[model samples]
Target: EGAVFIPASLAYLIGTNIFGPLAYKMGRSFSSGVVNAWNELSIPLAKKFEHLLAPNAGWGFAIGMVDSAMMPIMGHLVDLRHVSVYGSVYAIADVAFCLGFAIGSPAISGSIIQAIGFKWLMWVTAIVNMLYSPLMILLRNPSKKEEKEVSFNINIKILLTQSKIKE
Candidate 1:
Protein backbone atom coordinates (compact mmCIF):
# COMPACT_ATOMS: atom_id res chain seq x y z
CA GLU A 1 0.00 0.00 0.00
CA GLY A 2 2.80 2.40 0.98
CA ALA A 3 4.79 1.57 -2.17
CA VAL A 4 1.80 2.21 -4.37
CA PHE A 5 1.01 5.42 -2.48
CA ILE A 6 4.54 6.80 -2.91
CA PRO A 7 4.58 6.26 -6.67
CA ALA A 8 1.10 7.71 -6.97
CA SER A 9 2.22 10.79 -5.02
CA LEU A 10 5.35 11.19 -7.16
CA ALA A 11 3.29 10.91 -10.34
CA TYR A 12 0.98 13.67 -9.10
CA LEU A 13 4.04 15.83 -8.40
CA ILE A 14 5.51 15.25 -11.87
CA GLY A 15 2.14 15.78 -13.53
CA THR A 16 1.99 19.40 -12.32
CA ASN A 17 4.93 20.34 -14.61
CA ILE A 18 2.92 19.32 -17.69
CA PHE A 19 -0.34 20.78 -16.41
CA GLY A 20 1.27 24.11 -15.49
CA PRO A 21 2.30 24.91 -19.07
CA LEU A 22 -0.96 23.53 -20.43
CA ALA A 23 -2.87 25.78 -18.04
CA TYR A 24 -0.88 28.84 -19.13
CA LYS A 25 -1.42 28.12 -22.83
CA MET A 26 -5.10 27.28 -22.40
CA GLY A 27 -6.03 30.13 -20.00
CA ARG A 28 -7.20 29.67 -16.41
CA SER A 29 -10.87 29.03 -17.12
CA PHE A 30 -10.22 26.37 -19.72
CA SER A 31 -7.38 24.74 -17.80
CA SER A 32 -9.29 24.60 -14.52
CA GLY A 33 -12.51 23.58 -16.20
CA VAL A 34 -10.76 20.71 -17.95
CA VAL A 35 -9.16 19.52 -14.73
CA ASN A 36 -12.52 19.71 -12.94
CA ALA A 37 -14.18 17.89 -15.78
CA TRP A 38 -11.49 15.22 -15.78
CA ASN A 39 -12.02 14.61 -12.07
CA GLU A 40 -15.76 14.38 -12.58
CA LEU A 41 -15.44 12.16 -15.64
CA SER A 42 -12.99 9.80 -13.93
CA ILE A 43 -15.51 8.62 -11.32
CA PRO A 44 -17.75 7.03 -13.94
CA LEU A 45 -14.85 5.89 -16.09
CA ALA A 46 -13.01 4.27 -13.16
CA LYS A 47 -16.11 2.29 -12.15
CA LYS A 48 -16.55 0.88 -15.64
CA PHE A 49 -12.89 -0.06 -15.84
CA GLU A 50 -11.56 -3.08 -13.96
CA HIS A 51 -8.14 -1.60 -13.28
CA LEU A 52 -7.21 0.53 -10.27
CA LEU A 53 -7.22 4.14 -11.44
CA ALA A 54 -6.47 6.68 -8.79
CA PRO A 55 -6.89 10.38 -9.64
CA ASN A 56 -3.39 11.15 -8.44
CA ALA A 57 -2.02 8.31 -10.53
CA GLY A 58 -3.94 9.53 -13.58
CA TRP A 59 -2.60 13.06 -13.08
CA GLY A 60 0.96 11.79 -12.78
CA PHE A 61 0.63 9.55 -15.82
CA ALA A 62 -0.74 12.40 -17.92
CA ILE A 63 1.97 14.78 -16.76
CA GLY A 64 4.77 12.29 -17.46
CA MET A 65 3.42 11.45 -20.89
CA VAL A 66 3.00 15.08 -21.89
CA ASP A 67 6.44 16.14 -20.62
CA SER A 68 8.12 13.24 -22.39
CA ALA A 69 6.36 14.23 -25.61
CA MET A 70 7.22 17.92 -25.19
CA MET A 71 10.97 17.44 -24.56
CA PRO A 72 11.56 15.73 -27.88
CA ILE A 73 9.51 18.31 -29.77
CA MET A 74 11.30 21.15 -28.01
CA GLY A 75 14.66 19.62 -28.87
CA HIS A 76 13.70 19.38 -32.54
CA LEU A 77 12.46 22.98 -32.54
CA VAL A 78 15.73 24.13 -30.98
CA ASP A 79 17.77 22.33 -33.61
CA LEU A 80 15.72 23.73 -36.52
CA ARG A 81 15.07 27.25 -35.25
CA HIS A 82 17.46 30.14 -34.56
CA VAL A 83 18.96 29.91 -31.07
CA SER A 84 17.43 33.22 -30.01
CA VAL A 85 14.03 32.24 -31.30
CA TYR A 86 14.09 28.89 -29.55
CA GLY A 87 15.58 30.32 -26.37
CA SER A 88 13.12 33.21 -26.21
CA VAL A 89 10.14 30.99 -26.81
CA TYR A 90 11.27 28.42 -24.22
CA ALA A 91 12.18 31.11 -21.69
CA ILE A 92 8.81 32.82 -22.08
CA ALA A 93 6.93 29.55 -21.73
CA ASP A 94 8.98 28.53 -18.70
CA VAL A 95 8.57 31.90 -17.01
CA ALA A 96 4.87 31.97 -17.75
CA PHE A 97 4.42 28.49 -16.28
CA CYS A 98 6.40 29.41 -13.15
CA LEU A 99 4.56 32.68 -12.71
CA GLY A 100 1.21 30.99 -13.17
CA PHE A 101 1.94 28.32 -10.56
CA ALA A 102 3.69 30.62 -8.07
CA ILE A 103 1.26 33.50 -8.35
CA GLY A 104 -1.92 31.63 -9.19
CA SER A 105 -1.84 29.15 -6.27
CA PRO A 106 -1.50 31.69 -3.47
CA ALA A 107 -3.61 34.33 -5.21
CA ILE A 108 -6.53 31.94 -5.57
CA SER A 109 -6.49 30.96 -1.91
CA GLY A 110 -6.00 34.55 -0.73
CA SER A 111 -8.62 35.90 -3.09
CA ILE A 112 -11.21 33.51 -1.69
CA ILE A 113 -10.46 34.68 1.85
CA GLN A 114 -10.54 38.30 0.76
CA ALA A 115 -13.81 37.80 -1.08
CA ILE A 116 -15.55 37.03 2.17
CA GLY A 117 -15.14 40.64 3.29
CA PHE A 118 -13.17 42.78 0.83
CA LYS A 119 -14.80 41.69 -2.44
CA TRP A 120 -13.58 44.69 -4.43
CA LEU A 121 -10.04 44.26 -3.11
CA MET A 122 -10.13 40.60 -4.08
CA TRP A 123 -11.12 41.58 -7.63
CA VAL A 124 -8.32 44.16 -7.74
CA THR A 125 -5.72 41.61 -6.59
CA ALA A 126 -6.99 39.06 -9.11
CA ILE A 127 -6.43 41.67 -11.82
CA VAL A 128 -2.96 42.44 -10.49
CA ASN A 129 -2.02 38.76 -10.42
CA MET A 130 -3.24 38.39 -14.00
CA LEU A 131 -1.15 41.44 -15.00
CA TYR A 132 1.98 40.10 -13.26
CA SER A 133 2.74 37.55 -16.03
CA PRO A 134 3.06 40.23 -18.74
CA LEU A 135 5.19 42.41 -16.48
CA MET A 136 7.43 39.39 -15.82
CA ILE A 137 7.73 38.75 -19.56
CA LEU A 138 8.61 42.42 -20.20
CA LEU A 139 11.33 42.48 -17.55
CA ARG A 140 13.41 39.88 -19.35
CA ASN A 141 16.71 40.57 -17.64
CA PRO A 142 15.76 40.65 -14.00
CA SER A 143 18.56 40.37 -11.43
CA LYS A 144 19.25 36.80 -10.35
CA LYS A 145 19.43 36.29 -6.60
CA GLU A 146 21.63 33.19 -6.90
CA GLU A 147 24.21 35.06 -9.03
CA LYS A 148 24.20 37.91 -6.52
CA GLU A 149 24.77 35.44 -3.67
CA VAL A 150 27.62 33.77 -5.53
CA SER A 151 29.30 37.13 -6.21
CA PHE A 152 28.90 38.14 -2.59
CA ASN A 153 30.47 34.86 -1.47
CA ILE A 154 33.42 35.35 -3.82
CA ASN A 155 33.94 38.92 -2.56
CA ILE A 156 33.77 37.78 1.04
CA LYS A 157 36.37 35.04 0.35
CA ILE A 158 38.70 37.56 -1.35
CA LEU A 159 38.31 40.05 1.56
CA LEU A 160 39.00 37.32 4.14
CA THR A 161 42.08 36.07 2.24
CA GLN A 162 43.43 39.64 1.83
CA SER A 163 42.98 40.35 5.56
CA LYS A 164 44.88 37.14 6.40
CA ILE A 165 47.74 38.14 4.06
CA LYS A 166 47.90 41.59 5.71
CA GLU A 167 48.19 39.93 9.16
Candidate 2:
Protein backbone atom coordinates (compact mmCIF):
# COMPACT_ATOMS: atom_id res chain seq x y z
CA GLU A 1 0.00 0.00 0.00
CA GLY A 2 2.86 2.40 0.77
CA ALA A 3 4.49 1.46 -2.50
CA VAL A 4 1.23 2.09 -4.33
CA PHE A 5 0.41 5.34 -2.60
CA ILE A 6 3.90 6.88 -2.55
CA PRO A 7 4.23 6.93 -6.31
CA ALA A 8 0.69 8.12 -6.89
CA SER A 9 0.99 10.84 -4.31
CA LEU A 10 4.40 11.81 -5.66
CA ALA A 11 3.02 12.04 -9.18
CA TYR A 12 0.15 14.21 -7.98
CA LEU A 13 2.53 16.41 -6.08
CA ILE A 14 4.90 16.61 -9.02
CA GLY A 15 2.03 17.75 -11.20
CA THR A 16 1.39 20.54 -8.74
CA ASN A 17 5.14 21.32 -8.42
CA ILE A 18 5.18 20.14 -4.81
CA PHE A 19 6.94 16.83 -5.17
CA GLY A 20 10.69 16.33 -4.82
CA PRO A 21 13.07 13.53 -3.94
CA LEU A 22 13.55 15.09 -0.52
CA ALA A 23 9.84 14.77 0.06
CA TYR A 24 10.04 11.07 -0.80
CA LYS A 25 13.01 10.65 1.53
CA MET A 26 11.26 12.38 4.40
CA GLY A 27 8.12 10.35 3.83
CA ARG A 28 10.04 7.09 3.82
CA SER A 29 11.85 8.05 7.02
CA PHE A 30 8.59 8.96 8.71
CA SER A 31 7.02 5.67 7.59
CA SER A 32 9.92 3.63 8.98
CA GLY A 33 9.69 5.39 12.36
CA VAL A 34 5.93 4.84 12.56
CA VAL A 35 6.17 1.15 11.65
CA ASN A 36 8.97 0.55 14.11
CA ALA A 37 7.04 2.24 16.92
CA TRP A 38 3.91 0.21 16.16
CA ASN A 39 5.77 -3.12 16.14
CA GLU A 40 7.54 -2.30 19.41
CA LEU A 41 4.26 -1.42 21.12
CA SER A 42 2.28 -4.39 19.77
CA ILE A 43 3.63 -7.14 21.99
CA PRO A 44 3.39 -5.10 25.19
CA LEU A 45 -0.14 -4.04 24.33
CA ALA A 46 -1.11 -7.65 23.56
CA LYS A 47 0.34 -8.85 26.85
CA LYS A 48 -1.38 -6.14 28.83
CA PHE A 49 -4.73 -6.95 27.25
CA GLU A 50 -4.26 -10.74 27.25
CA HIS A 51 -5.98 -11.42 30.58
CA LEU A 52 -8.98 -9.43 29.38
CA LEU A 53 -9.09 -10.84 25.85
CA ALA A 54 -7.92 -13.72 23.68
CA PRO A 55 -4.99 -14.16 21.33
CA ASN A 56 -5.64 -14.00 17.57
CA ALA A 57 -7.95 -11.12 18.35
CA GLY A 58 -8.79 -8.14 16.07
CA TRP A 59 -7.31 -5.31 18.12
CA GLY A 60 -3.94 -5.52 16.41
CA PHE A 61 -5.69 -5.58 13.06
CA ALA A 62 -7.75 -2.51 13.95
CA ILE A 63 -4.63 -0.56 14.91
CA GLY A 64 -2.83 -1.78 11.77
CA MET A 65 -5.62 -0.53 9.50
CA VAL A 66 -5.64 2.85 11.16
CA ASP A 67 -1.89 3.11 10.80
CA SER A 68 -2.02 2.11 7.14
CA ALA A 69 -4.55 4.82 6.33
CA MET A 70 -2.52 7.36 8.25
CA MET A 71 0.82 6.82 6.45
CA PRO A 72 -0.10 8.03 2.98
CA ILE A 73 -1.99 10.98 4.44
CA MET A 74 1.11 11.91 6.39
CA GLY A 75 3.24 11.52 3.28
CA HIS A 76 1.01 13.93 1.41
CA LEU A 77 1.04 16.42 4.23
CA VAL A 78 4.83 16.43 4.38
CA ASP A 79 4.93 16.82 0.63
CA LEU A 80 2.71 19.89 0.83
CA ARG A 81 4.67 21.71 3.53
CA HIS A 82 8.19 22.64 4.60
CA VAL A 83 10.31 19.69 5.71
CA SER A 84 11.11 20.93 9.24
CA VAL A 85 7.51 21.79 10.01
CA TYR A 86 6.18 18.59 8.49
CA GLY A 87 8.74 16.50 10.30
CA SER A 88 7.94 18.14 13.62
CA VAL A 89 4.21 17.64 13.09
CA TYR A 90 4.74 14.00 12.21
CA ALA A 91 7.00 13.54 15.23
CA ILE A 92 4.30 14.87 17.49
CA ALA A 93 1.69 12.63 15.86
CA ASP A 94 3.96 9.60 16.12
CA VAL A 95 4.50 10.23 19.82
CA ALA A 96 0.75 10.60 20.37
CA PHE A 97 -0.04 7.45 18.41
CA CYS A 98 2.53 5.38 20.27
CA LEU A 99 1.36 6.68 23.64
CA GLY A 100 -2.26 6.07 22.71
CA PHE A 101 -1.59 2.50 21.65
CA ALA A 102 0.44 1.83 24.77
CA ILE A 103 -2.08 3.37 27.20
CA GLY A 104 -5.44 2.99 25.48
CA SER A 105 -5.33 -0.60 24.23
CA PRO A 106 -5.44 -2.37 27.58
CA ALA A 107 -7.82 0.15 29.09
CA ILE A 108 -10.20 -0.13 26.16
CA SER A 109 -10.06 -3.91 26.13
CA GLY A 110 -10.68 -4.17 29.88
CA SER A 111 -13.57 -1.73 29.73
CA ILE A 112 -15.22 -3.50 26.80
CA ILE A 113 -14.81 -6.92 28.34
CA GLN A 114 -16.18 -5.69 31.67
CA ALA A 115 -19.13 -3.76 30.31
CA ILE A 116 -20.36 -6.57 28.11
CA GLY A 117 -18.60 -9.91 27.73
CA PHE A 118 -16.36 -11.95 25.46
CA LYS A 119 -19.21 -12.35 22.97
CA TRP A 120 -19.49 -8.61 22.75
CA LEU A 121 -15.75 -8.56 22.42
CA MET A 122 -15.87 -10.50 19.16
CA TRP A 123 -18.84 -8.45 17.92
CA VAL A 124 -17.24 -5.14 18.77
CA THR A 125 -13.97 -6.19 17.17
CA ALA A 126 -15.59 -7.55 14.03
CA ILE A 127 -17.91 -4.59 13.57
CA VAL A 128 -14.96 -2.25 13.85
CA ASN A 129 -12.63 -4.23 11.49
CA MET A 130 -11.51 -7.56 10.04
CA LEU A 131 -8.19 -9.40 10.01
CA TYR A 132 -7.18 -13.05 10.17
CA SER A 133 -4.45 -14.21 12.54
CA PRO A 134 -2.93 -17.57 11.68
CA LEU A 135 -2.98 -20.35 14.27
CA MET A 136 0.63 -20.94 15.27
CA ILE A 137 -0.36 -24.09 17.14
CA LEU A 138 -1.33 -25.74 13.85
CA LEU A 139 2.16 -25.23 12.44
CA ARG A 140 5.08 -27.65 12.76
CA ASN A 141 8.81 -27.32 12.21
CA PRO A 142 10.62 -30.04 10.27
CA SER A 143 13.10 -32.17 12.17
CA LYS A 144 16.76 -32.15 11.06
CA LYS A 145 16.46 -35.66 9.59
CA GLU A 146 13.29 -34.72 7.74
CA GLU A 147 14.99 -31.59 6.37
CA LYS A 148 17.93 -33.61 4.93
CA GLU A 149 15.58 -36.20 3.41
CA VAL A 150 13.46 -33.48 1.77
CA SER A 151 16.54 -31.73 0.35
CA PHE A 152 17.96 -35.04 -0.99
CA ASN A 153 14.66 -35.99 -2.59
CA ILE A 154 14.34 -32.58 -4.26
CA ASN A 155 17.91 -32.79 -5.67
CA ILE A 156 17.38 -36.35 -6.97
CA LYS A 157 14.12 -35.35 -8.64
CA ILE A 158 15.76 -32.33 -10.27
CA LEU A 159 18.70 -34.42 -11.57
CA LEU A 160 16.42 -37.14 -13.01
CA THR A 161 14.15 -34.58 -14.64
CA GLN A 162 17.08 -32.74 -16.23
CA SER A 163 18.64 -35.99 -17.55
CA LYS A 164 15.34 -37.06 -19.09
CA ILE A 165 14.91 -33.67 -20.79
CA LYS A 166 18.47 -33.98 -22.24
CA GLU A 167 17.49 -37.27 -23.97
Which number leads on lDDT? 1
Each candidate: RMSD: 14.4, 18.9
TM-scores of the candidates in the order shown: 0.36, 0.34
What's the residue-level lDDT of 81 in candidate 2? 43
List candidate 1 stretches off by more than 4 Å: 1-7, 12-37, 40-53, 74-84, 109-167
Give the Cα error of residue 41 in candidate 2, in Å: 23
Give model 2's TM-score versus the native structure: 0.34
Instruction: Output the lDDT of residue 86, model 1.
Output: 70
lDDT (Cα, tens digit) per residue for candidate 2, span 9-108: 4433342233233334333233323433333334334434343232222233333333544545554555544453566667877998888778777777
Give the number of colliding residue pairs in candidate 2.
0
Question: What tens digits encode model 1's per-residue C-alpha lDDT throughout 1-167?
Answer: 34535554677577656655553344323233233334434433344333334654654554454444444344444554435357766676678768877987688757665656444444444455444534433222333335566789999999999999999
- Model 2 residue 74 CA deviation in Å: 0.6
What lDDT score goes with residue 111 in model 2? 84
Candidate of highest TM-score: 1
Q: lDDT for model 1, on a 0 to 1 scale?
A: 0.51
